[model samples]
Target: MTSEFAVELRDVVKRFVTPEGNEIAAVDHVTMQIKNGEFFSMLGSSGCGKTTSLRMIAGFEWTTEGEVYIEGNPMGHTPPFQRKVNTVFQSYALFQHMTVFQNIAFGLEMEGAKEDEIKQRVGRALEMVQLTGMERRKPKQLSGGQQQRVAVARALVKTPDVLLLDEPLGALDLKLRKEMQLELKALQQQLGITFIYVTHDQEEALTMSDRIAVMSNGRVQQIGTPVEIYERPSNKFVADFIGESNFLDGQIKSLSKDEAQVFIPALNTELRGIPISQGLVKGEDVVVSIRPEKIRITEKNAKNDNFFKAKVTNTVYIGADTHVYTESQGVKIKVLEQNHISRLDTSSFYTVGQEVGLVLMPENTLVLKKV
Candidate 1:
């Protein structure tokens, strides 16, 4: 572990003995480094070891194998408060009887800090979260978003080297959660402190993280920026989990440096220039994943190598875009297109059972491993 990393998990594993006397690894062989002052996230669904990993880092759960290092120092027996880290949980666990100021200053008071210093630190932390002048109110007087801010301020007043957040925004509604994503990202950058966030929501992870570590089954599938994860997934799990993708089974006919020709059985034709995954070979069975938004649905046929004509089965006109569903060769294809044209005219939008052309360009197509 290097000093540049704020936290390092070297093959950390957490195992629990099930009631059936079976041992299961909740966090298995996970190894990664969180860069200093970076907003990193562990994203996965429930029981995928995301929260267990955070607990290990926060000293709630001890590592069963490997080591956890903070700032190049091993955290073998160090306790939570002594390890220079604080955690903001999903519940926003505040004292109901205490005022906002008291909750925020409680940690400092626990450390035996002078009253004057605790007041100054708590005031600054409140200012950082933009919740100043509401010090006298109790947790019951605040909204969900305000209570979340109080939780953040309470942890931040400690000035820990790293802040561990376990789905802090999971309690908020959709709109407020989205708003806090941007706000938290901005605050992290302004403070230049490491933040380790955990979330199961894909959109929230993409919205806030500087880089994401996508985990599943207690293992990391891939780690990259939001664009890389969405654009080029490493395997089937990643492709299916990140976003909506139309997967078509195929076999590689030929492969080149940047593209591959795949033979899709449903279409009974070969698609050329489909981007291939690393180490893909010819004649190997693969899956061609193309996002619905990438396909263009129009009346005119594009006489290119990667075009298909199908009959539209359904059309749904949402506010910003329309989801057009078409079927051809026993394969249902979904196309998402922007409603840049007028929708008042029902004739303009493709009606059900109407013939439409779908263009799957090479730039937007991704050929993935079967896995």
Candidate 2:
């Protein structure tokens, strides 16, 4: 019988022995369920177990504990070729000496498929990636993007149930990488296949993934949609990693069903915020997180709840937005404001040492556990 999940890792762990003969858990008890036809991403920096988890799913490495299930079946000792999945790596892994057609057809040829069937499948796969006419060219003749597409086509020609991509766009320039991110998302949607992507770039994961698993220190920190992960991080690590957040060390002064009052010692005020982390209690130490863009700054002297008097310390303009650095009661905070209005004069911008009011809305403020 078919399952709703395309892949599942049940408390998976992968341990490696260091050259000094010390054992370390590269993947520490990671558990996740990837739905069929979903674009799931494992995002983290290097040595965070994101790549090791992907390799485990791809059969390059086996779990030291727990099990890996693919399509409701346990994949114990299943070889890469036997599993109904394919992977495209950062290097593209295209054969240098072969034409695009030959490289794409190599997998099918190994499966001992008839020549006509191989050609038909290869043509369809190439068309899927918009590389139909480039089959006769060598890998060297194609541009970086084109070669990447050829690599994708080779993987797609096999028609696996799931596709694994390990930083496939890492080699491309920024502009091309941005372009390919959209293309890959569109292709995944069009094909309606499960895609398990691994990348360290936060923006890339946010742009392309339907859901993301944020990993760090051999453990999965949080898994949710891009908006959820960015807007409501589970802990300090997630808040600081996924995006820029101004964190205030605080203690819970009072608690309600959905909101909490946090007393920040640095600011000497109690700020109200929605408590997102589980098991929060009254008088518990917590961290108040607010995104740089969420804090509103105005020149008007508005005294209200959660409002602070801040002085501008620095200002930076980067075409689309201006980053304003400020200090309130000795606490450093950064604010990002968009250039919504076109202006030629610098008079409207905040000046250094200018006093301003910062409004931190309770809805936009997040209270996380102090991990």
Q: Provide the lDDT at 91 for model 1.
A: 96
Clash totals in order: 0, 0
Candidate 2 lDDT, 52-148, residue by residue in tens: 9998999999999989999989998899889988999889989999999999999899899999999999999998888888888999999999999
Candidate 1 per-residue lDDT, tens place, 1-371, comes to 24999999999999999999999999999999999999999999999899999999999889999899999999997888678899998999999999999999999998999999999999999999999999999999999999999999999999889999999999999998988999999999998989999999999999889889999999988989899999988887888899888999999999889789999998987888877668899899999999999987655566766888899899898989999889988999888988888898888788788887788888888888887
Off by over 4 Å in 1: none
TM-score of each: 0.96, 0.97
For candidate 2, the per-residue lDDT at 127 reads 88
For model 1, give the 10-residue run with minimal summed lDDT.
Answer: 296-305
Worst 10 residues of 2 by lDDT: 269-278
